[model samples]
Target: MDRPDHDRASAFDADSRRRVQVLVIGGGQAGLAAGYYLRRAGLDFAILDANPAPGGAWQHYWDSLRLFSPAEYSSLPGRPMPHQTGAPYPNARHVAAYLAAYEDRYHLPVHRPVHVTGIERSPDHLTIHTSADTWHAQAVVFATGSWQRPFVPAVPGRELFTGHQLHTTGYRRAADFAGQRVVVVGGGNSGAQIAADLTAVTETRWVTRRPPHFLPDSVDGRALFELATHQVRAHAAGDTHTGVASLGDIVATAPVRAARDSGLLAAHPMFDRLSPTGPVWTDGSTWDCDTIIWCTGFRPDLAATRALEDPRIHLLGYGNWTGPASATLVGVGRTARTAVEQIRTLLG
Candidate 1:
């Protein structure tokens, strides 16, 4: 099989930072996908991941998180994400296990606990500085998925609110706020699902910049992915189409459906400003809130990449800065392949 196959061990100098043809940053799905293609092309490369374990940010997801897609649809390029015998949709931990196994199965030379500090460009090669050592490479691919950087928008009275404020990153379990009041902000899936989950234990209010759109209960992430694929293909072919779903639309998962049936899926426009007591509406009405769960999303963790002056540094998956599916697990494979081919062309 022409996959990210490995035949020999990674060769590094005694300093543990030796020069290779290419270096891949971030060992999450994106990085792993890049490794697959890079290996198939038989390039000498190494993958560096920051997490001490297999899962990148999957290890830190909220307790109740579930993939909107079933296991078959949620996998990386070569391997189908393994799952529990009866479980249709895999949880975060299941994904974590699959990723760990995928790395081992392919014998991908992944170095762990190597938190990248920065990147520097030299006349001959790019220098990757990590917590461990410095490495030299002729080319670099950035597959660093954007989970480390959580983004919360600026709002009035953000400093005035002394109440507990947490982004979705730090949110673990809903029971922590069992008796409290929460204002879950954002219109995306996380905001919808988290608001729904919080309703089981807390008095929750859902706030969004715009109306939250939900796909039919029969629809899930697979459909979204296919729709996206269609859109990309259509764009390539210069065709216009309609009646497909974007990934941003919420999926009516079991939890979400239950919440909707119980009248918990209602959404309100974003409040005027944040107050110590809660959020205040334009009419100056206030709710007694104790926490604002900002499911506000994240930005691309491209700080180090931006600092480089080289034109050869190509970045994958940090969200569509590259392509339609640049940031997605299933989508990054094609993006990686295209990137590697481009790198080969440049190297020639």
Candidate 2:
């Protein structure tokens, strides 16, 4: 697919080729966080992001969506999100604006709208090739995050009906589907939120692969923000090597419970088949719908740098780490502070 052209793309010149201590491949929360720590440690690094603006993945969310996390919890290190005229849960635009402001405030050196096409490593440095330019660095951090690509399941006749099929990533607002019968697949947080928002303006149905455990946005006056914090602490303390196992447990207990009790969502069985008309349930039931929103999930796009054996190029830390002169992966921590600390230590 052709990339969006909101920012100018620059060509890589051999004479202009620059060397840095670290190369951050993403400009999202994780990438910026790593940059923050690297800067504090006085390390030479640069951030290359595909988006025209900072705020990372937040810019792709629906228009009416607000973060489940409050402003306080969402703030990055050494900077605070400017408060808007709203409650604790700021909408997607607000979050995006905050990240943009952060980039300006910190003077973060980021190459915007430059898509990274591939990455390779030499004996002493890493080579990052983008659509616009190439970068050479001693270490590269894949802060691209987990949500690199949207996951849409292969269903029969998916292309036939297609009135306006979109993933949660492309969904902007309920008004886009006003007065339409929409069926949203996946009962995760995104699925629930989309269904709930659409319910206010259109007929909606939520289909899931399995019964999801829902939790309230809050529990006993405590937000679920602590979950990320706890995982970061555990990883930093060497008590755990992976954060997914712990995050999965917390998500199961919290958001899963909240969504189930929302009473706005109607849980349908797994999607058994798809036709031009609509999707069929596992029990052989059919529901005619005008639009289908896939909220399945996403995966990291590491094909660009698959040849690298450095710890920096990992898939949840499951890839091979047996390369000469071990290259450390920094900023994999789940929480903001913990991720910053990890970057700090790695840089040191």
Candidate 3:
């Protein structure tokens, strides 16, 4: 059985520096998936998570956030997520529970609330510096994902806008903006879902660079994952005509579909700049908004990897820059397996 947090902390305190064969960063879906493979490969590895809890970034998501795919389709390697009660697409809490259970089932060595500060690479090994201790490892798997690095595009006169502004990371629920007029910026799934989420509670305007592209209602995350897989295979085979990008951007989830069908989710064109009260268009029209919610996407939290460029260090689950569909739960398993395989070869 795994020791309690206090026992683990005491152990780390006794010896501030430790050695491991491998170190996996960010105990989210990707890191856990990597742990699964590392365990099966008989590698001595430990997962370092910045969060205090087992659920990783999922625990921090908004209450209403749901997976794009069903439970069975959104699972990590070696385990299928348990079906959620009453909901085909599981919510954030259910996902978090499943992840916690996965961690326990595998008995993966995970250190929590241990923030990694930086890493220095030598000719033979990597020295990892964290808030809790120092670790020397033969290799490092960076599965930090992107939740910590939310990206918001710069719009003109943003500083002059006196109203409240927040990224999707800070948004919890629509009721928080109950009586306010809100503008949700971005045209992706997040913006559409959040705009749809707000329609019942307050006035909301969805802004996008172009008209929002809605995938067919029949197309969900499963089909999208298959398409991405096919696209990746095609690219590897030297054929770049896979047509994955041709499929529309947004997944038509239940709420998004309902809002769109009711005409409450209609999107507006991107504004030229921001005014004191709200966003202004090139035509000099402006809508008064009490708050601005940027549903902009995220960048990979890879700051620690900047100081070193070593082949022993591999990155997973940061979107296409690492691998196709790598950031998604179902997609991360393949990437994690590949990463572990490479690590095995290097360690041998």
Candidate 4:
């Protein structure tokens, strides 16, 4: 992978503060997509990333995690991810490499390890406060994403749990829970996959508020994106139609499929409360488990812009609120492109 062009000297003003027409927060896939269009628009822009290296949140995901779609369907705006041999879906490392290469291929201006503290608005520009330097920009593309703030729903007696508890963020490998009873919470892909991951090495139980929903084995990220896109177009044309939810929650990935075939993927209802040792269902049934992994999901890390209400500041890649399927690799391009065009007109 080509290294990102970190030479940001040209973006600095006379006072040594960096200034640009556009400032993209988060150097992950969403921010990079925004950078691709911003670069093409001939805008003087900079991407401020909090990580010490490339790959955004992908680098932080658990091992054995794979995209639900093949690499060709999971690409950024300018290039397709190189195909992987002997695998239907690329793993997280492959994704990170693709992103880093995309940055180099496009030569996007990316500043790394630069944590953006907050955003301040002036009459004509937005001032970005960062750990390293202050940046002034005509517009800001907030693509920080949700990984920074993992969500765990408030279950009763959660604080009193004596065993280990962690969100999906801290989970790295299934081997970590070997020989122990583990409960994986949530009905999303993460929960299903994590439960699958743990089932082989340990005693595992899957829990959700409702019975888990499973998409057909034929469905993958590609199909899901297409459905979401159709829904978006339908909505724009004043048609209210069912969206991706019509399919189901979790995609039947290889691991999840295997676990299901083995009859180990059966899900239990979410526990009503937690005892010191484990969880207690509404009917007073309890299961003793050594650890709980909450895969509930995430909220957008938009705290930096929480205090400001500026029209020039655009949010991207959080979820449907930003754009349909905007959080996905292939889905973010459309939203980023439109946001850049709007930013260009606003700057002009």
TM-score each candidate.
0.92, 0.79, 0.96, 0.96
Per-residue C-alpha lDDT of model 1 across residues 250-323, encoded as one tens digit per residue = 88889998998888879999988988788998998888788999999998887777544465687888765587
Count of backbone clashes for each model? 0, 10, 0, 0
Query: Which runs in model 3 stand beyond 4 Å of their true positions?
Result: 1-13
After TM-score superposition, the amount by which residue 135's alpha carbon in candidate 2 deviates from its true location, in angstroms, is 1.5
Write the residue-wise lDDT of candidate 4 on 1-348 in tens digits.
334255442244446667788999999999999999998999999898888778989999999999988999999998999988887799998899889888888888888778888888879888899888888898999989999999989899999999999999999999988899999999999999999999989999899998888998999998998898898889989987658886798999988999999999999999999999999999999999999999999988987886445779899998888899999999999999999999999988
Off by over 4 Å in 4: 1-4, 7-15
Backbone clash total for model 4 is 0
What TM-score would candidate 2 get against the native?
A: 0.79
Q: What digit string (tens of lDDT, one per residue) describes model 3 on residues 231-292?
A: 88898999977756677999999999999999999999999999899999999999999999
lDDT of each: 0.82, 0.64, 0.89, 0.89
* lDDT of model 2, residue 224: 42
Q: What C-alpha lDDT, on a 0 to 100 scale, does residue 319 get in candidate 1?
A: 65
Q: Can you give the lDDT of residue 298 in candidate 1?
A: 93
Q: Write the per-residue lDDT of candidate 2 for residues 1-348, one digit (tens) a residue.
A: 112222322233458776787777788776776677667767787888878666777888888676655566567767766666856667777877777777766667777777889887777677888887677876777767545678898876677765568888888888988999999988676787777777768888888777655553333112343443455467668876544332332232333344445665677777777778888766788888899999887766566777655744422221112111111122222333333445456546
TM-score winner between 1 and 3, please give it: 3
Off by over 4 Å in 1: 1-17, 240-248, 307-311
